[model samples]
Target: MTLKSFSGVALAALAVTFLSAASAQANDISKCVLSGEKGSVAITPVNEGAITVETALPNPAWWNGDTPDQIADGYEYCLAANIAHRAGFDKVNLVVSSFPALIANANQNKDLAMATISITDERKKVLSFSAPYFSSDIGVMVKAGTKVDAETVKTFRIGVLQGTTGAKFVSERIKPAEEKVYAENPAMFAALMAGQIDAAITDTAIILGQAAKSNGALTVAAQYQTGEFYGAIYPKESPNKEAMDKIIDDMRADGTLAKLASTYLADSWGADPTKVPYLKP
Candidate 1:
């Protein structure tokens, strides 16, 4: 072949190769995203190259409810899936585990934990956290007919999930007259209904969900803007921290995060957290 023709052909081949690689990367991220409702996992191998993502599914409304027998579903779970996909994971193994174990695994550099983990000064010592993706300003849930407010919060019997920011808020800020600790939301909320406690303090999402499901039997009374944002847990120096934070930041910049939260989590949150009414700490 003529030298000029050979050079042109070679350049065309290289161009094709580069385009192919870029296309594959784009394809990877697109297919890696959540299998939104009306989309079928059986048809689209969105998770073909899935990476393990651990989370403690607190409830259907709080976390994704996907089981081995079902598809990935939930607010935080979908949020994690979106961020993971953007970070270049095709799919998430979406393992259900405990919060403590999830944190331990992150400490061990095992898997990415995307549960609704509140960032705190103490946890920052051992774990790297992505930029805040959710807020955990303390919120209150009172039985539907039980009226209360920030000023009188101290007099009511309060239930809070142990070891949570809500528990801390009550213990340190409000110092309720009577307080009870439960292991999880169900237990804490059950106490409220059983009259074991007159109210519950927790993150807005949990309290909103519980109140909604209570069918007017419970309602949110107060929201405290604690400046606590949810951060995904990572190993102390894992590289994923920066990448995950970038993706979350981009989502926020592009209004993607707001849209996701509104669609999947607003019911549980009751309002846009960024603009919602909150109690002064």
Candidate 2:
């Protein structure tokens, strides 16, 4: 019969059928199918048979441990392991490198780098990034009991990591009285503890991790919803980007990403980042 002549129940059944078809279309695997074997997508190795994934050290909740070999536990580390398995690599050569250095060289020294590197239009020029794996918002931190809000944040002396979106936010939005840029997280947090800067701005999860380990010396005073997403960086010329993106998208579509976040970051990050109070900037 004609669709316009259908009864209410018939219309409902037709609607459900249409929705099911749409869902199936959205999850079509053909879009992300691997070019090589199902698991062993051919990838140029940085070290023999291993897929070398570089990440900066001392990244707290995202990457703990002093060295790559001794990596105890963290969300990003777990992600690296999963990537290796899906790519059919028996070994994962985890290496250390700063975010700025990796981005500058476009991971020339490794197969890929997952240093909680955010995906941005500007960075896409120098690096090929996989589908986003994590989302983050900008956060403002201060020594405990040192009060500051969205309005007052602009007046404080701010500390930021060089070449980070947080640093860019501080300069363009906060316009704080003074800005101190550090090449790394440790140095910037140290400056905050020493009273060198009145506030620090960066990813909410990062600041929260620092505050949790600070023993009452620091607190995440404010945050802004910058709607940032982190992506794994592949070399500009790498042919494996498509396959890697498929793998990451699969992980995200499944419950793998959520499980990893709970296993590595639930306790350390405390409250949900989105639930944190948002500052109107």
Candidate 3:
């Protein structure tokens, strides 16, 4: 080949190499399996395992022949579907891990956390939080006839999701007679249903979701005034923080967030649509 032709080919190869390196750098999030639409954020599952909001079956089917796929059509499942849609993503992978691990993994991998992570001053020190996706108060879940009231349940054995605001609130505000820390909300709720604990403490929204699925097998004793809100978590130094924040702000301003909460969380948790918490710059 002539020298001119060879030089042109070499330049094309160099450009290709540079583009590939930039793309790899852009997608460097460890363990983040990017699928579905653009800007999709992943959530860690509750406890059982990964359940896709887009295609998973409902959990509370009344029919004996109902498969897991059939039950995925419940409101809670649709709520997750709504969250993904409002967040501008068609899908979000759920990673099942403890709250601490979720935070740690998000930080270490430089991936955004779509877990049902509550925003608190303590967590703010280590991570940036998107707008309040769901508002929930701490509450106690107990059997149908359990002798527990909001005020009196402080002395009962309470199960809490480990490393969550619910756990922190129980430890600081309401000292339970005994504390059982589970890695995820579902496990804590399961423990309550199984009669292994007197009560389970968690976000009202989550407990309500479980109660809805269990067909009134559980009841909320009382909602506490923790004033907690769940948000999408990101590394403290994430460049996408500004973009994520802007998306949340837009959602809040445009009534998208309220609509999502009302559809998924309002009936069960009484989440106020007007009570979105503002994030700091």
List, residue by residue over 41-92, the lDDT tens digit for candidate 2: 5565667766778888788767767786567557777666666666776556
Clashing pairs in 2: none
Model 1 C-alpha lDDT per residue in residues 27-48, reported as the tens digit of each score: 2332222322211121212234
Better of 1 and 3 by TM-score: 1
Q: Which candidate comes out best when scored by lDDT?
A: 2
Instruction: Name the weakest run of 10 consecutive residues (lDDT summed) in model 1.
Output: 36-45
Better of 1 and 2 by TM-score: 2
**Candidate 1: RMSD to truth:** 13.3
> What is the Å distance of residue 100 in model 1 from its true position?
4.2
Off by over 4 Å in 1: 1-48, 66-71, 100-110, 268-277
TM-score of each: 0.75, 0.83, 0.62
- Candidate 3 residues lying further than 4 Å off, grouped into runs, are 1-96, 106-111, 267-281
Candidate 2 has its poorest 10 consecutive residues by lDDT at 27-36
Candidate-wise lDDT, in order: 0.61, 0.71, 0.51
| All-Cα superposition RMSD per candidate | 13.3, 10.0, 16.7
lDDT of 2: 0.71
Candidates 2 and 3, the one with greater lDDT: 2
Error of 2 at 231 (Å): 0.5
